[model samples]
Target chain A: MKISVQADAFDPGAELNAFSAGAAGAGAVVSFSGVVRDEGGRLSGISIEHYPAMTGKAIGAIAAEAVERWDLSDALVIHRHGDLAPGEVIMMVATAARHRAAAFAAAEFLMDYLKSRAPFWKKEYHADGAEWVAAKDSDEDALGRWAG
Target chain B: MKISVQADAFDPGAELNAFSAGAAGAGAVVSFSGVVRDEGGRLSGISIEHYPAMTGKAIGAIAAEAVERWDLSDALVIHRHGDLAPGEVIMMVATAARHRAAAFAAAEFLMDYLKSRAPFWKKEYHADGAEWVAAKDSDEDALGRWAG
Candidate 1:
């Protein structure tokens, strides 16, 4: 298991390759990447803020749960906080398991938790002004599927 | 959309990076990779065979269907045939969409089709002899979920 909460930009492709290489005995690998989207030409960029102390700990706990539940061989989560331009990757999750079902399920589970439950605040910038992005009802609904 | 059925080794990470770079306006990207698993110490390697003329066409058709059904920004599929050693990548599927749900669903759908419906044959080699690999009931059942 590996988790990183950093402001610096990371290469998703390079990280994925490294993760796959390190998963020695796994037969299936799944990855999900979330990129900042420009909703129309009105958007400029976005800024993400997090509680430094609690952010990593929270993500680590959820990732650990995913690993145990899915019997994953390995798992990785990387999230970026700070200013990000449209098309910039905001975060990524990867999972490895002996079977494809487990890997895919774990990756999806991690992504749902990160999107809806993670402690991150996002502010979207526009030409007129900037506003904090609100939690989406769709995201909340998506997260509900994973609830036990 | 891109589909390839080849015997030569390919870099999954490199391909993923290329695919993501080409997908403009997509906010979510998902990828699945299948690796050759060595079942215990008795297994040596495996050989995959495909119908040269129909393989690419079949994959392309399914990929196109996924893109239309899921409203995907892009989709990619790559499968390698011929002898493969343990830990080598056998195939990969990738999908990009404005939302994470569509991206994840399309990728999984592509994988299920590839696993059960794709025209590929496998022969697993052991220390003593080689035997033809048969389709699993689980894989068949997985495909049923996507049925119309």
Candidate 2:
């Protein structure tokens, strides 16, 4: 498993290729990329902040849980901080397993944890002003589906 | 939407990159890749045969349904035929949408359909002999999840 919390932008496809190459023995691979959306063209950009000290550790633990739960051959999470323009990639998760179901489940599990549990703050900037994004009840509900 | 049934070996990562790049403005993108598994090191390789005339049309119809159902910004499916070594990619599906749920669901839906309904025949080759692979009951169950 691999986790990276960085300000530098990265290519999702390139990262995917690297992960797939490292996970050669796995029979299935699934990936999710979260991009900064324009919100019906009303948004200009988004700014993300993270606790550098805790970010990697928190994400790593989540990834570990997914790997164990799904018996994954490998897993990866990459999250970017700092200002990001619309259409930019903000975060990504990838999972590999012996079957497609496991791979897809693990990827979704990681994404849910990342949205609700990971220590990240986001602010969206639009024509009017910038606003701090709040945790959506829907996101919380999404998290609930995975609860034991 | 794009669907290809080919004999040529294509790079999954490269294809993903191209698809992602073209699917700009979408907030979420999901992808799944199926690789040939060695199965306890007993399998030598796998051979896949397809009805070339109907394969593309059938897959394209499935993809169209997913796009409409999920309100996808884009979708892609690629399947390779002929002989494939263990660890070689057999097929891939990708979906882009405004949210992660739709993207993930569409990708999974496409995969379930491809596994159970696509016009492809698979035969696994082992040290002893080769066996024609049959559709799993699990695959049928998986397809049922998306029924109306």
Shift in Å, residue B85, candidate 2: 1.1
Write the residue-wise lDDT of candidate 2 on B22-47 in tens digits.
Answer: 77678899999888887768899999
- lDDT string for model 2 (A1-148, tens) is 7888989999888898788877668989999998888777899999999998889889999999999999999999999999999878898999999889999999999999999889999999999999999889998999888889
The reply for model 1, stretches above 4 Å from the true place, is none
Model 1 TM-score, 2 decimals = 0.97
lDDT of 2: 0.91
Q: When only chain A is evaluated, what TM-score does every model earn?
A: 0.95, 0.97
All candidates' TM-scores?
0.97, 0.97
Cα lDDT for residue B134, candidate 2:
81
Task: Give the per-residue lDDT digits (tens) of candidate 1, residues A68-130.
Answer: 999999999999999999878899999999998999899999988888778999999999999
lDDT of 1 by residue, B44-139 (tens): 899999898888888998999999999999999999999999878899999999998899999999999998778999999998999999899999
